[model samples]
Target: MSRTGIATGPNALRGIVMMCLGMACLAINDAFAKYLTDVYSPVQILFLRNLIALPFAVIIAVRLGGWDAMRTRRPGLHLLRGTLWLAAATLFFTGLRYLGLAEATVLIFAAPVIITGISALFLGETVGWRRWSAVLVGLVGVIVVVRPGGDAFQAASLFPLATAFLYAILMISSRWVPAEESLWTTMVFQVLAAGALAGLASLWFWTPVALSDLWLFIGIALAGTLGMTLITEAFRFSEAAVVAPFDYTALIWATLLGYLIWNETPDAMTWLGAAIIIGSGIFIILREARPG
Candidate 1:
């Protein structure tokens, strides 16, 4: 390990370790969220998760940049981004109530693929025919996974796919947010906005929490914090291209967790569809990496 506590190496081995651990943490977060879904509303989960994290976000900002660290040049953008984040979180957890964790995770990964098209349309960025073709193939993989016309398909699967689009918008806004804005500012706005919105929305179907479920709530908060911290650092240390495809590692972690914790084994078709989505996603990444 390096002095920073994260390992340092140009080798794929170390990268794989970091990537797998990061994804495992994220999968654990999702698993906890799914379990809580049976009892808690999306807003409740969001409130508790961020309430546990909000103080730390403030502390981090103060430690790193003092009071000024929380400053933002664009309140409107912050509100807009927080809305997207809230929408993504709500839809994703709502989807979880009906879909398996692994299935939902794969569908959400479609966000980046959608982002390519969004950028082409809105940002005037050029997406060549080749990349556009890859996007179509990726959508086909999604259709296979969702299998809309088939009995295997659940209506809830669409929620995750829709959330993916919201996430893409969140990411696009993040890309445009002023660079001078501190991470603390961004984190604060996101947690506060999502937490408050979810809490209010959950009022319609709120349930009393048992003492035991409270324990799980603690785990959700801690694990979520850890997972998001790792993901943020992953972006800092590695190139986006290098770290992006590593997100597919979530499928592996979700599969294992689904088996061990929930005993939910995805059928053959799910695995096959996951493989196609991942393979096509990697192909898109590689295409971006190559010289024009």
Candidate 2:
């Protein structure tokens, strides 16, 4: 483990690489989900995606250890984390219906900044003035993109903002989970819990999916599960602060996919705001990495 006791080692390069690839996978998954939104409710999409991922999570769990690895002392925390995951996914997918891929992506990227504050408040972690200033700048960036009362504003914009908050809470909670709990087990619990919750919500909004769309559902599930696994491994190898900055790579992927697939382009203000948010987030990560 690293000197910081964050349950990661000192291999920052490997962590950064894994995080970049994982972000790519996640971006592709989001693109697929956005495309499928044309035909399915977000609830149905989430249920199917998790259902397909459950078996893969089980396989990884058993391979990592026996079924015993799945046993955890912190079941309640797992449940809470899973709920947050479900909520974040629901909000993001719903928001995608109204927001372009790049715009939605830049909005959610605000999570890291929100996480810094949440860590300070809820986890009682120390935050220096520099980091706090960075957080404020990041929030300003988000406001610039959201433009609360401007013509660019839409109620749907709030979905990604809320998603970012919930995602921050989920990340903070992960830090509290016992390090001994295998990554596979943590992943399994999260998928199962999210799937169960989504399944319940699906009953009210279920719609028949065409046979042609089955592959898209499977792709979403595989991409998301693999991305989660890679990011989990990334954290195991390096400090979260060291690896997290790479997540901004998703903006690049989102930009390319948005233009190629839908001809959607983010406005100048959106790009400006994204630049500010990303810059502030990177500063926070770098500051946290410094010796205190």
Candidate 3:
């Protein structure tokens, strides 16, 4: 079936479930990246992650169709999307070095709200007052979590917020991509383009990896590639708004992983802010799901 044609009966439910699974993989990947940040720079981590993931992506692309499946008329758009992906990953990984996993996860959840706004402004989609209000409330949740000028705040906290904005842009841009393009093609471009860009940047900050750490780099590649492929498939089988809210599930995974692996815990304020953000995001999803 064509990529866009995958959205059919029962696919919406499947999409939601797949999105949750994808988020779990992503949360685990983030934890691994955070752990590696202790010894490697963000660029180095990004370069390795993308470089390792590229082969798997290429395999998937070929399975979907031969090399011709990866062809695209809109190279510039793919390049732009790839650049945004690189920026988002770099910022989020860098922020993870300082912020607790759960905190960073919650902040990134704000992307749905930003995506809603961007869809309205740039995609020219009609957004009702209710969803707009939800967007505003979601921003409040972000502010609560950041707690700017307060002791809980770190300048690094802004990195995830910026990442969320860039990710929102990437998601919006994806909607513009021709549906006929194979999902594997898009995925391949994302890894290849980001890998090339990060490879150039890693030259200055490169750090030698111990033989023992090779497994971590491999894990990063597998988790990231698999996670993103599942999420992309979820979007293929469901509406973006329908699949998006499930992304908030990442916070739950991140919280558990953070505590077990790093002994990190989110304070009461962070929990409260997360609840607010999640609530607002759910409201937006519900509003969008309704008939106009």
Pick by lDDT: which candidate is best?
Answer: 2
| TM-score sort, best first | 2, 3, 1
Residue-level lDDT of model 2, residues 128-205, one tens digit each, is 899999999999999999999998798999999999999988877788889888877788999888999899999999
What candidate 2 gets wrong by more than 4 Å, as runs, is 1-12
Residue 68's lDDT within candidate 3 is: 73
Residues 162-271, model 3: lDDT tens digits: 99999989977887788888777788888888899999999999999999999999998998888887898898788877787788899999999999999999999899
- In model 2, the worst 10-residue window by lDDT is 1-10
Could you give candidate 1's per-residue lDDT for residues 1-292 as a string of tens digits? Answer: 4443334367434455566677888788889989999888887887888878777777766775678777878878877887788788878989989888889988987887888889899899899998898888888888889998899989999999999999988888888778887776787778777777667776886788889888788788777766766666666666556666888989988888888888888888877778777877887776776655
TM-score of each: 0.90, 0.92, 0.91
Model 3 stretches with alpha carbons more than 4 Å out:
1-13, 121-124, 237-242
Cα displacement (Å) at residue 204, model 1? 2.8
Given candidate 1, what's the lDDT at residue 139?
A: 87
Candidate 3, position 113, lDDT:
94
Tell me the RMSD of model 1 versus the true structure.
Answer: 4.1
lDDT order, best first, reads: 2, 3, 1
Clashes of 2: 0
Error in Å for residue 143 of model 3: 1.0
